[model samples]
Every structure is written in structure tokens, then in C-alpha cells.
Target: MTKGRSTTWQERIDIVQYCLAHQHDYHKTADHFQVSYQQVYQWVKKFEDGGQDALKDGRGRKKAPEELTEADRQKLEMKKMEY
Candidate 1:
């Protein structure tokens, strides 16, 4: 992998597979993949519970629009008129 900090989904899966084939040895997996032991453990757990989908970033996260009060709309209209 490059010097970039983030790893790709495929890379995570490969690491998980290696760990699994090695009898779930977290420490060896981490050392072999240049990652933390905890990371290996979490990835395996996520993979087991949710398959590859769980390994993706922002699994359930979403950006929601900000809620605006009526007063906020009035202020926006005033600002538009001033422009």
C-alpha cells in the first residue's frame, strides 16, 4: 500500500481473510498487515456480523438538512431584499 493512512475496502477484506486463515490470530495479522491489533479484531467482527457491507465507511451515517424556524426564513427573506 502507499503511504496514505486510509486503506481500501479490498485491502481490509484481504487482511480479514488472512487473519481468518491464520486461525484468527489478531497480533500476527496486525504485524503482517502493518495495522493495529484492535483494527484487525474490529474488522473481523464487522465482517462476520455484516459481511463486506459493514466494512465500508459511513455504514449508517447520513447528512441531514438543518431545521430552520419560521423566523429563520423571515431573516433570509430580509437578507435577500437587502442584496
Candidate 2:
């Protein structure tokens, strides 16, 4: 969290997307986002490991996807059939 300016959750996500789309121009991106070159690199890394979700407000750690229990899934399918 650098000083001077702060970005919203959506803004951070957009910055990551922009960095991924323009990886070849790292300096340009740094200037556009008003951040350092290393920050741009970090954003690209986050996008690569995960998708847009990685850019959101959090501890910057990825939690494994939750899996539905076998019984729960069966119940859901049964309910869907009734509709």
C-alpha cells in the first residue's frame, strides 16, 4: 500500500487486467497506474496464478475452491428435477 493515492477493489482488478494486456510495455503501465514497475510485475503474476478474483481486496493469498459434498450434490440434483 503505497502512499499518496489509493485504489478501489475494482480499480486494482482493472489495473491487473491492463497489466496483463500490455505486459510488453511495463514502464508505460507503471506510468498509467501511477505505481512502480515492480507493482506492475506483481499484478501480472497475480493474474497468471488466478484470474480476476486474484486482484480483489484480500490478503493476496488464494484459497482452494470449495467442493460440494456428494450428498449435497445429489440433493441439489433431485430438487432441480422437481422444478
Candidate 3:
């Protein structure tokens, strides 16, 4: 299984849907999609938890202050305090 394979947002959504349609079989989904089993599992879980929007890639994306969760804001404050 290929690890860290880069897939488009649509591809992730398709994989998640396929996995769900096939009874959440991560191994079969991964094999069919040429992605790692872990990727299939994580994508399906993300889809279930947050719907299709969660399948979007978040790499190199930054959240605005208002968008940050309480724990994230606290961690940012702690980092600033250390400087």
C-alpha cells in the first residue's frame, strides 16, 4: 500500500463514498484506490464526522484568529509568551 499518496479533494470524497458503500471495508477501499489503508480509514472517519467538506486538503492552510478553537488559541498564546 502506498503511504502519503497525494489525492485530490474529489478523489478523497469518492474514496470515502466507496468505502461507505462497501460496508466500511478500509482494506478493500485502499486497495481499489491505490491509497494506504490508513488513508481510507481516516478519510471515511472524517467524512462521517464532518461530511464531504472534511475531505478537503488542509495542508498549508492557516485559520484566522476567529476560526481558531479555544485550545488552538491557547497554544498560540503560549507560543507567544515563550518569545
Question: Between prediction 2 and prediction 3, which has the larger lDDT?
Answer: 3
TM-score of each: 0.65, 0.55, 0.71
Per-residue lDDT of candidate 2, residues 1-83 (tens digit): 33336677778777777766775477777788887777677767886888777767677665433566777778778999998
What are the lDDT scores of the predictions, listed in order? 0.86, 0.72, 0.90
Which structure is stronger by lDDT: 1 or 2? 1
**Runs of candidate 3 exceeding 4 Å displacement:** 63-83
How many Å off is the CA of 21 in candidate 3? 0.8
Tens-digit lDDT track of model 3 for 1-83: 57677889998999998999999999899989899998888888899999989888888989999999999999999999999
Colliding pairs, model 3: none
Native RMSD of candidate 3 (Å): 4.0
lDDT of model 3 at residue 83?
92
Query: Which portions of model 1 miss their true places by more than 4 Å?
Result: 1-4, 59-83
Against the true structure, whose TM-score is highest? Answer: 3
Worst 10 residues of 1 by lDDT: 59-68
